[model samples]
Target: MTSRKEHALKRRDLAVNKLTSLGDRIIDDVAKQTVPAIRVPSRGTSNIVYDEDRRYYVLGDRYGQRSLGNVKQIKKIGQMVYMANFCKGLVQTGKTATLREMYYVSEGWDIDFGDQQESNIVGEDLEVTLGITREDLGLMPEEDGASVYGDITLKDDDVEINAMRMGKSGYTISPTIDEVELLDHNVERVIAVETMGMFHRMVQENAYKKFNTLIVGLKGQAARATRRFLKRVNEELGLPVYICNDGDPWGFHIAMVIISGSAKLAHVNHELATPNAKFLGVTASDIVNYDLPTDPLKDIDVLRLKELYKDPRYRDEFWKVEIKKMLKIGKKAEQQSFSKYGLEYVVDTYIPEKLDAL
Candidate 1:
């Protein structure tokens, strides 16, 4: 296995090579005295396609171009080039920046971004063009938003830390997960729960010990860091990844995002998606079968379910069947609904049944 330092160096070199390739093409285009145009895969909704084989969303054929000749797009082209240089600098110098910092840092650039969103688009444009994730380019999110608790041991650089030792809050998952290595672990599975309350209960009850699994708290929609960690757990540790969330569209989409990748982030799906991850429970069918306490489906919930019903990722027979059931019942269930049985039911009966089903 390659050492983390060596791996980081190789990755940085490759990123710089890609950035240099883009630079060379633009320089050559300029020398020819013709308009320099760079074409990236269109990030529009219509241009996002689900790859059935890979089981993830990917960029489609439709192209969005930034050309020097197009006055409206030239400013963005300048930002793209500058952003490419920024990424190259980051990788070369062994430094990092947040997207917000990247936006503010542009104060020094001639082709400065108008706002963080504009700067973010430039960074995303680089991602689509280079086929590299923002983390690989040394740009990280403002905060690491997920936590983990379990028997798994991880090596963050050279220091080894036992996840279970962390209190109820658990270990904060790192967005730049490539830098961390999984150490020897006794965990059999990884269970990622969507709610903070449930995560706390699991942690407090020593659920990891009960199931011999690592339980990660997603703090709602799983952040990039949490998803990356889950993918690593799935691929590297060969542990099954299962998500337990509500029986609504939002919860369903969260599981789908972890499993198949979201359309908005198609470019980095390979790095973040876990195609084999399973939705543990709280399915529309589970809502009926478990007879868990439920709340009436809101208008927004119905709309989202309808949209997901048409989404290719949710086209599986199980998804189709469950979504129809939920719509028919006009009710949604939450993970907290399991509390109706008792505080221990989720960890004891409910979880085991779902695990056995898998």
Candidate 2:
């Protein structure tokens, strides 16, 4: 196995090689009096394929689009060059920068991005073009979207974290998960929650102890670090993972991101997605079975459901039935709705029932 330091060096070398090759190509194109073209993964579900064997979504080799002689193409080339140089600097200095910092850096360099969103598009393109993550470019996200609680220990460099021993609330999962090593854990499974309210409820109720499981809060969408940590736990510890989210479209998408990976992060999907993770609750049938409270589906929720209903990645029979049922019911359920039975119902009744069914 390669050491982390060695891996970082290799990644840096690869980035440098790519930059050198790109520069060579541009010179060659100029010499030949031809257009300089670059290829990037298409930024949508269309170019993303579901790998049944891997149980995750991956970017396909389909030719998305070619940047040639258009003004947009010229602008993209400039952005890519700038990003490559930025990454090179980070590698040379052995430093890291946040996504916000990168955006500000671009602004400081007088990159003509209208807003942060535009800057992010260029960053995504760079990831696809380089076949690496923004993190590999030494850019971190601002939000740390996960928290952990269980009989687990993490060793990050010289610092050690015993999650279960970290007071009553447990440890906040670090954003720099790639730099951390999972030293030890003695848990049967990991239960990942999508909402903070339910996560707090589970922690307050000692759900991890009751079920002999590890609890992680996604806070909504799982961050790259959070997903990477989940992947490591599942692969290294050999623990079955379960995702708990609302029955709404957004919650379902969150689960999908964990289980199958997202198109935007296809470059690092293998390192991030927990392919064996199962959906534990808030299924459409739970609406009928548990007699949970329901909120009327919003316009956006309905639109998103319709989109997922037709998505190729969501073609499973079970998912199809679930979405159909949701459409028919015209309502969505939250994880918190399980509280209707009792505050302890989720930690005691709902979780145990779902675990037994697994």
Candidate 3:
């Protein structure tokens, strides 16, 4: 029942167990496996601060105990000890002297030296393993949902139904229905809705059950990944995708992430590509037809639109037209702006109508 605070205080008061006494045997075992002749080095004359400042050794074990909780003092001593131990370990191990070699050698726990040599050795790979590898480790496994981490391998039989669409750069897919359930074995339509409000409204109106929609909110990289995955579905499974986003620069950017890849994650094109997918709602031209809010369009949005208009990579007629039209209107319209039409507008008018038009 002891709280963290109580446990920490008790630990501080208790006799310190040196690392050598606690787990030195483990390190010795590792050394024996790797280097059977390994031997502990004897103390020698050194210029290290701890070695030179003999006052601490003379002051007994309680030398730095007075300032135990002083963060700055503790950090300073930690840095000196770390650097000395690292150099000594390197010399003894005869490992490579290169930066990358050193990087891999001394990883996992971080050591800060007051400079900006920040390196995360056990980085995303560890995260991926922890999040995704656990499920696959067990011999007799149980059914787990598609989680971010753990080992859940995908098999052909697992995919009940698949659809695909091909476009200029690649392809994309529509969400498949779960065929395992006998009565509910029909193919589902995968709809990409940028706004969560719009998604919620669509769900309330039974858009998923009616059209079998998989409402994905595509903000930033998720949009790009969705697009890339859609493209793959299109190419591999011949599925067509419909995009529903606001009629603005950022929305267009989100759609483009599916159609072509975002600049930052362009390398992910292999997974998702809906090159043939069509943009179906709230275009720059729609501004002229519909009433737009007078709030001056974001300056940065205008700037990005101009960049898109000029960029050769985004030379699609649709992109050029929309970007130029936004520059002309000088206004941005959100999916919520069309809320006056009500949720029925999205379900009865937008969803069915858009797909029929497509």
Candidate 4:
């Protein structure tokens, strides 16, 4: 009598032969145009001997199953097999399946190995599950490739660009503003300005003339660069930095950059952006205090604000006041939306008032 191991191997071979035969027939049919098309198996087809629930085929020491490739990977591998089988059947109708077909059959062995999402350290197949690097799918060669680090070193100018790339889903860094240009050691106050022209004008007008008020331009590359430079400034100068972005989702995101750091660039949180940076202007509270126009607020914004308010990581008294103000206003008032009256209003009232309070 055959040993159980021997029986398993024989069954495995038989199943492989059956799959091989089925693949060959499907290809032949496709080649002959007998059927409109052959749809590749998705998930896994039940093996006759394994029954529906077992979901595995006999291998040397155990059962086997199919690799549930991600939808895209499944299609790619399936199409290749379909084409090969079609051509092979045409060339040699009854010949034994080629090594290519055998390889796919063996690839299916991963199924019988008992590796699944519950037991697996990594997701079932990160490549397939998350649709990330193909190697994560276990389809790529096992050999390790070159390290991710490159020989390229970043210059001062490249930091913003690199940070932007790194922070694709989050806020951009602000440009660097020399505190010395604003004031000398006698500087006492810091102001976070949003617009470049306004910032430049404020600087030119000597708005920050006496105080060390930082006139940050929270728009474009300047803001992004400023975010990065702020780290160095804080470390070197031992001065407190403040934030002043427009009042909008984008603006909120910018503040979040300084306050919490972008998801991918979180490592640079303490290094680039300052967490304690206060929002000095254009807050939800400014709606009533500055008396600005309002836009119809969407539920999404309200929900997002609520979430932000609840976030223990970023929740602060300043944020609480702003969020409550927005809840009271029931609308949004972006600084850019403000007309000349609003702009002047900000320069005249908002800036002056906040400066006094600060």
Candidate 5:
């Protein structure tokens, strides 16, 4: 078996090769006294398509041209070159930078980025251009990754760590797991929760011990790192994943994104999407079934549900039925809605009932 270190090294070497090729192309164009142009893969929604075999959304074959011939695009080309050079330096040194750090780093460049959003796009351009992930290019996440708690053991570079020994706060999932090794697991299933509050409550209740499961807190719509880690847990650890979140339309979309992949990140869906993951989160029907307190749905929420009903990912009968039920009820509930009974209600009552049905 290839060790995790070897895998990371191979990825690093691939990134370096791509970066060098990009630089050579620009230099060759300059030496030939021609308008230097590069074809950047389109990251737009129009270029996103569902791959039935892969079971995820991926980028279609559409390219955008960045050329020095166009004065309007000169600045963009400049920014791309600078960003590529920076990433090359990072890969060469075996160092990593967060997107935020890249934004700040751009301030020192001759053609600096207008803002963080612009900086982020340039970084993404490199990934699509190279056919690799930002992580592969030595880019880290600007925000910290998600939180996880369970009866599991992981090794991060020479250190052996136990999830149980980490206490109630548990372990915060790192931005990349390329070098992290899963040594062993005492868990049976994986519960991926959206809110930190509910995740902490479950941990406080000894749900991991009681249920023999790993609990991951996604902290809203999961970032790429979190989704990738969940894929690892489901595939490598052989643990089934069930997402838990609010009963709102956004919550439903979050779960679907993990299962079917989102258009915004279609390029890296193969690394991030986990189609086998199930959405066991709240449903609008829960309002009537459990007599739970709920706030009236906003017009936006209704609009979103109508849109989801037409989304290819939500074509399943289970989603359509749930969307209609939510529309009929016109209300939504949070995961904490179970707390109306007691703090232990989620672990002792609600979760047990849901798991038994599964």
Candidate 6:
């Protein structure tokens, strides 16, 4: 296994190469008396292509927006240069920075971003331009999400944890998935739960042990580490992956991101997304079939569902039927709604039934 230092050094080299190329381009443009242009992938669905074979989305290099001559392009170039220098400094000093810290660092740049959103856009631009992730540049986002009751041992830096032996409440996953090594695990499948309430209930009920499975709590939208860890577990460990989320548009999106990758993080989709991961229940149909309690679909839920309905990735017949049913019913159900029969129903009945079907 490559040590953290070795990994960091490799990333540093890549960053250096990117900077050198940019500098060379600028020099060449100057020599030719022409505008210096940097091409970056456009950040949207239009620039993202789904790899049906891999079951993940990747950013296409076919079309790129050139940063050249215009005031906006000039400011963007300044931000890129600023970010490159900052990342270089981090690598040289063997230091790490948080996304928030990087945002603050932009305050000292020649170009005023006016807000954190503008600064974040430049950071994303660097990811696309450099073909590297923010994490590769030693920038960490706020840590959220965890795993519990997995028959797996993880070594993060000096800390080693046996996930299953952590009693009822399992270990909090490391913020940096790159830093964590899965020493061993004897599990058949990994179930990523979207809600913490359901996750906690499953752990409390020892659901993982009962089903010989691993449970990962996404909390809501998954963190980079959670997604990366899940991807590694699926790819390296060869575990069947499943996701359980609420029967709503947002929940569906969470599952989609886990399975096909998010457009925003398209550059690192291969490293983080598990395209083969199957979508397990708490589906729109589950509400009616299980007689689970339901809440009226909110305006936001309808809007999100409408958007998802239009997305090409969600055009499957099952998705179409589920979404159509949701729109027709105008209601959504949370995973916790299964608790109406008793919390044990989800672990004892629902999950097992889903596994049998799988």
lDDT string for model 5 (239-304, tens) is 899998899999999999999898888988888899999998888766788888898999999999
Cα lDDT tens digits for candidate 6, 50-88: 777777778877656565687767777877777877887
Per-residue accuracy of model 2 over 1-358 as CA lDDT, tens digit each = 6654566578767766776676687778879998877777676767777778887777888755555688757776887778778877886776788877887888777556777787788878877877777776777788875888889988876788898898766778766677676778888989999877888898899998898889898888888888888888898779988999999999988998888897766667887888788888698888978988999899998899999998766888989999999988898999999888889998888888888887
Off by over 4 Å in 4: 1-186, 200-205, 210-212, 220-224, 336-345
Candidate 5 lDDT (Cα, 0 to 1): 0.87
Give the per-residue lDDT of model 4 (tens digit) for 21-86.
546765676688664233322222231122122222211222222322345344434433443333
Cα displacement (Å) at residue 169, model 4: 28
Candidate 4 residue 319 Cα shift, in angstroms, is 1.6
* Better structure of 3 and 5 per TM-score: 5
> Which residue pairs show collisions in model 2?
none
Clashes of each: 0, 0, 28, 17, 0, 0
The alpha-carbon deviation from the true structure for residue 231 of candidate 4, after best TM-score superposition, in angstroms, is 1.8
Give me the runs in candidate 3 sitting further than 4 Å from their true place.
Answer: 1-185, 209-212, 219-229, 292-294
Candidate lDDT values, in order: 0.87, 0.81, 0.44, 0.44, 0.87, 0.80
Select the stronger candidate by TM-score from 1 and 4: 1
After superposing candidate 6 on the true structure, give the runs of residues whose Cα lies further than 4 Å from its correct spot: 1-9, 27-35, 62-72, 165-168
Q: State residue 279's C-alpha deviation in candidate 6, in Å.
A: 0.9
CA lDDT, candidate 3, residue 104: 44
Q: Please, what is the TM-score per model?
A: 0.95, 0.87, 0.49, 0.45, 0.94, 0.89
Model 2 earns a TM-score of: 0.87
Q: Tens-digit lDDT track for model 1 on 267-298?
A: 88998999999998598778888888999999
